[model samples]
Target: MNITFQKNAVTLLGTPLKEGEKMPDFTVCDNSLQEVKGGDLSGVRIFAVVPSLDTGVCDLEIKRFNEKASQYPDVKLYAVSLDLPFAQARWCGANGVNAVTTLSDYRERDFGRVTGTLIQELSLLTRAIFLVDDDNVVRYVEYVPEITDHPDYDTLEQKLNQVIRAQ
Candidate 1:
């Protein structure tokens, strides 16, 4: 899909995963540099894809989600980024962001490619949000048209509530 990056044209490779589609499994590294595959994650997952954690908007977005994640213990809020595992750990520790688990896709960009969030020019994942059920089926997806903007958290919260209630 073609998503705008600060209103500039950018090409996102692969087909975007949508609602009701089973999320494809992929492996990514966590803070400890341990491989974490999609199957390794249990319960409902709320994936927040960001290009990088060093930027202002991405940092704020991650912090916001980290705070809101405490409300839903059953849901795993994954902050996906292209940052290295060491950098991710440092950022989490420095920012006191413990609620959301930070994942590193720097090695392979598997998550980016699978979700169709990879920016071809920048080689980074675009800002997006995905809600996958316990069954691994996607329940909601939000591809932010602009890379620097925040996601629609209100809609995300509503969808999360509905998905949780249905389960």
Candidate 2:
């Protein structure tokens, strides 16, 4: 069974995305499994952090961002993963992570597909970071090519600062 992976030139995951482009609206599940849509997050800068959450790098990334999220109270940080809502809640509870909002995209919402983070053969979401402005415009995007690598935090932080300053 040769499954042809639908590739999009959007970014690393082959989803069609570009810098300065308006981000597409989406609805994902929050920690409580409640529906969370893009509109619900209007008027706030969004730090969309995609991670597998089952790997060491992903764990570190979330931990680091969770700590840093506190410094930017104005921004809404969302840690997105394909993990089930139950797993997300359990992880948050076990780790005492409450600073950043945790979201799950595994309810057939195709968030991984839309974000271009879905691994074609592995059924996993690739690690990516998208910084969206309050108006839902994509200001910055970083998709690490290697699954084991971490995102470029320096550049991401720089763009985040710029967006915050612009507001």
What are the models' TM-scores? 0.97, 0.86
List pairs with backbone clashes in candidate 1. Answer: none
Per-residue alpha-carbon lDDT of candidate 1 for residues 1-167, written as tens digits (9 for 90 to 100): 55788789999976799899999888899999999998778789999999999999999999998888779989999999999999999999999999999999998888888889889988999999999988888999999989989999999999999999999
Off by over 4 Å in 1: none
Deviation of model 1 at 44, angstroms: 0.9
Model 2 stretches with alpha carbons more than 4 Å out:
1-14
Query: Per-residue lDDT tens digits of candidate 2, residues 1-167?
Result: 11122332223344645679887766789878888876667655555445567578878888788888878888877888888888888887887778877888888645676667766566667767888888788898776666666789889899999999998
Error of 2 at 133 (Å): 0.6
Name the 10 consecutive residues with the lowest summed lDDT in model 2.
1-10
